[model samples]
Target: MSRVSRRRFLEDSLIAAAIAATWAPSRAESEGSLGRKVGPNERINIAVLGVHGRGLDHVKSFAKMKDVAVVAIVDPDSNCFEKAVKAVEELGKPTPKTVQDLRRILDDKDIDAVSIATPNHWHALAAIWAMQAGKDVYVEKPVSHNVLEGRRMVEAARKYKRICQTGTQIRSAVGSREAIKFIHEGGIGTVYLARGLCYKRRDSIGKLPDGPVPQGVDYDIWLGPAPKRPFNPNRFHYNWHWNWDYGNGDIGNQGIHQMDVARWALKKNKLPNSVISLGGRFGYEDDGQTPNTQLAFMDYGDAQLIFEVRGLPTPDLLGVKIGNIIYGSEGYVAFTSYSTAVVFDSKGQKVKEFDGGGDHYRNFIDAMRSRKESDLTADIEEGHLSSALCHIANISYRLGSPQPFNPRTKAFGDDKEAYETIGRFEKHLAENGINLNEATYRLGPKLVLDPEKESFVGSAEANALLTREYRKPFVVPDKV
Candidate 1:
């Protein structure tokens, strides 16, 4: 057997043993709602990283849990430290711990678990390090910035016998599980295609000439594993969700959630055999590197799935509904972001509809105490697979030629048919209010990819982006 496979097998064996040894009865497993349990609060000492944005939600949720205590909060931004300190102080509990460095938090042997809400680039590294430090991990979605990092995280978790959960909170929703179960059980008979959509409006990320570091922000540390670039406020805070260096556009940010649900209902654990993606920034002119509007199709032999993202304000998109639809042989299942799901037959008659609402953090804490990874409705592997699908689409779009559609044929004709392809891309952009005439588009041409190898087939430029150059002293080693 290969070294990696051998290592994986041994790690799996160790994890199995750990699970068996640490088994504890969970009230939720029997009594439904997770409530006060037996013993002296047996609270798990926890530290949270990236306590800004969604990080605050993690803290608030964990604080309400009977068996979990927020022991520390870490963030590179001093502003976040101040906010987190106030939050912990308001909890009516003693000031637990506070730090600006994650390394210090990880080094503290007293911490039993960690919740990571850092940017996409930091997800995998933080999780892997936490696992190595013998702490269970709860990492936010789009679990890795790239494919290899996610695989590495899974390996590290297994090797260290850590209970790791991905923050695709929707999976734990009672309604979500029921919807998926119904679809799998033939409510959506012979499911052929699962479609996901995100149609949220976003403004420009400013046109400020990039320069100067912001006060109280460690811009250098923030760019640890990513290539250094001029600091721009447009590329910080929520705006980071749009940049290629720090984010995966809406696909990884929001679309991944619905994509996750689709994959779960479909029970797929690997990438599709073939993929085709098209679209670009169609509305507002922004500093974002990824497409503002895009469509991706994945061919999975017997079935296919499509992922669509519209960052622009597109009217009547997805039949005037913004959510996911699973088209099956007999019926379809539709889910809204509000956690509402309904099944409709070929006749367009509604058959079943339900609401999925619940607390995600409570579920993770329950699973942690039970020592059963399966108890996690959305496991790390599941999140990785869904996120990988999004990554594949983005990668394909980056490699594919800018093709314009021919109105007569209603199909795209690319550079091979240069005139027709360019026409289609141009027309599509114009229809969506993008002005190609205003400026040049930095478009990438089509290239072959070998997903198994995690590299481009013949393109050096494309392959170079697969992994980033890390800064000195903050680098994530090639091998742990």
Candidate 2:
């Protein structure tokens, strides 16, 4: 990975970035066909992994596509399989096989692709193994558990020549594509900044004692790659998003969507030159270790991106919450929802609007038949890079401490907007009756990062976090 140059990384990844922002499909990408042609009437056999929350969506969505079949459902919890099988049946699709482990599904030569909605820890590994088993893949957003895993996921897709898609469905939304097109066409003038706002409230998880594993659940398989531990409700199901071992916190949970949009608007391929975060899990005490409130600023040289996450109950900022606020010199665009974009002028008057409709699943199916990775919205690289930002932000927060920073010099110097943002964040918390001792609050060091090498400069602690040690058999191989 160190041998990979910045230019090469940017050049290789720019296609996805451009496609995401401008909806401009290259000639080669538009015309290329999947190595093996699947006639219009041919069927694409897919298996949905991790059949719980997001996984159920995969089962139903695939079941509706013409000539696409949900051949199997995989999950460590038998209860999840039951629910997914019911979902498939309710959709009028033939009942698919249900399995408690992914290995059996991977062995079936008939499977064409795997729709993976597994836990964050399982995402990269499952996708890689599926591709290794001679199948294409449609992985959910933040495609890796760690930065290193993301890079490896991209390598596996390319090395195996498999068609892979990321589940950042906004890329398929007509409104989002049109909005980005507008931004790039001078509608928004010179875009220099983007603010991703996630202001939803999360109540305390309240500590729970480690409990016995539920019957019919392959707990060992569920814990694959993650550290060995007793099963607790807080660490399972939707709650996993708040646990660092299984999730990337709210920023990685719902925040990745906005982060992807911010990067797309800037056409950023390589990562930011520097990053810093200040915040913590305030409001209440619980089993959740990840911060409930966070402010992360990424300096991308010419421009900057700011992401704010507030889990305590709060009102929207400038009528925007859990959405993206892209600021340009002349105007701005607010992605209000999955399918709606509202553009505003410098005077705060709404200028243009766009509505959305498109199926990311259908996009993948079309690309699978064409055999061109570009035809699909959110290719694997797109997912990896966007997901990497989440991991990067987490590292900064994990190693944070109150420190001075300068937005002008792009390093630690006199304080500026970064300080202002944190100041406002603190004020908001206080307004909501949450107060910190101030001293315990951490502000990350203004660590310099080399985009080309994808590592921190002169910081062994930060560099070591780029990857992680994997357990045997479940390990994410360095070479993919």
Candidate 3:
């Protein structure tokens, strides 16, 4: 067997053992009594997981809802509990019980749902566990560490008959809804391509030596699905977004919002037929593992999606710094923010604009009450599809080799848009003082995928990347 295949075999064996030893569906799980229906007048009790950053938003959003209660705050970092508690108490709501580990609250009959804003690595396992425990879920974007875990989350949601929502809150926005409607109505005639941009500047997380775990931090639980390693400030808290072990870089981080919008504009629900990615961590070197400036091209036969992630400073495209520009034959739509978009004709003339917002939390609560997955604006299936796009692109990039920059190569075969995008990417790097003559970028192979199977075609190496090696007791089961 090839080295990659052999390694995958060992990993799969270990994962199977872990799942068999650690996981089993109980009678309560089978009957789905871990969750209780919330009456119209009754409150929906919730636990906000990973209350360090985004989880705090969940606490504040839910604490203000008349029919929702922030019953508990969960995080591996106990230090974050104070701020979360303060936010709830300041809102005139009762102080929420704080816990460091999510597993501690899984069996709580009072907690009806879990808003998972944990790190990317923990998203799938957390959501699956909550679903098994009969709790509904509102997991953040790029909902899994890898592609297979996402499908597992979907299966668990289906089996448990849970009201699971993706945290792509843009789907709940009034403006986004109207804009999508306009596209579907042919406001942008014959849409063929979508360009998602993530031009937000990211500073380097400077090198830091291995250090003692912070006080009050349940380090082991924090490392849950991720491999155990000595603590480093660069790989903790917010900085973990750049690490491959715990995060999916900016593409899966801030870029996922735009990526989802791009895919939504195309109205494609399945994975792309093929994908290619090329870029590197340019400008400055640090402990960061993922690329700072990257370009991914996903081919969907008749339509195409191009996503750009520029971590260094750069100019906006069509007045958007971190948004989507969906190109149609007659006109195009440009998203300015999560809840706002502008439609322009072929001549760049302003046609229409959509500007408004809606409450994603409220939408989730409504679906939970109705006990219908169809009521959700961004259901688990939608989340899995979009999150899978990011994973496949990353998988291609990971299997790539360093190649010198070349603008004239027909790597994209006759796709002019792809070539033009590469030109722009080169210029963007040059403007940021990247010397192309000396530095080389990782040019990933164009990987063909069987969308129906959700696996790569004839590439065991790529298929192995669809999932990851699991840590015991925290494994995302093969059978949900």
Candidate topping TM-score: 3
Query: Residue 188 CA error for candidate 2 (Å)?
Result: 1.5
Q: How many clashing pairs per prediction, in order? A: 6, 6, 0
Candidate 3, residues 9-127: lDDT per residue as tens digits?
A: 57745654554465555678866663776778999999999988998899999999988889899998889999999999999989889877677677788889999999999999999
lDDT of 3: 0.90
Predictions ranked by lDDT, top down? 3, 2, 1
Q: Write the per-residue lDDT of candidate 1 for residues 1-480, one digit (tens) a residue.
A: 789967965774465345434433233322222222323457688888888799998887787665677889887676787777677668765576766557666556567889999999888877876776667889999998877677777776665656789998888788877888888888868988887777666666756678787655667657767787898887888788888888998889988888888777777777676565667776666678887777776667677677767665555333524678888999888887647788888988988887969887887787778767888877788877888878877777777665434332223243133333345446555776665556344333444556566556676866665666766555555654
> On lDDT, who's better, 2 or 3?
3
Model 1 CA lDDT for position 100: 54
For all candidates in order, the CA lDDT equals 0.72, 0.82, 0.90
Instruction: Write down the TM-score of every candidate.
Output: 0.83, 0.89, 0.94
Task: State in Å the error of residue 262, model 3.
Answer: 0.9
Candidates sorted by TM-score, best first: 3, 2, 1
Clash total of candidate 3: 0
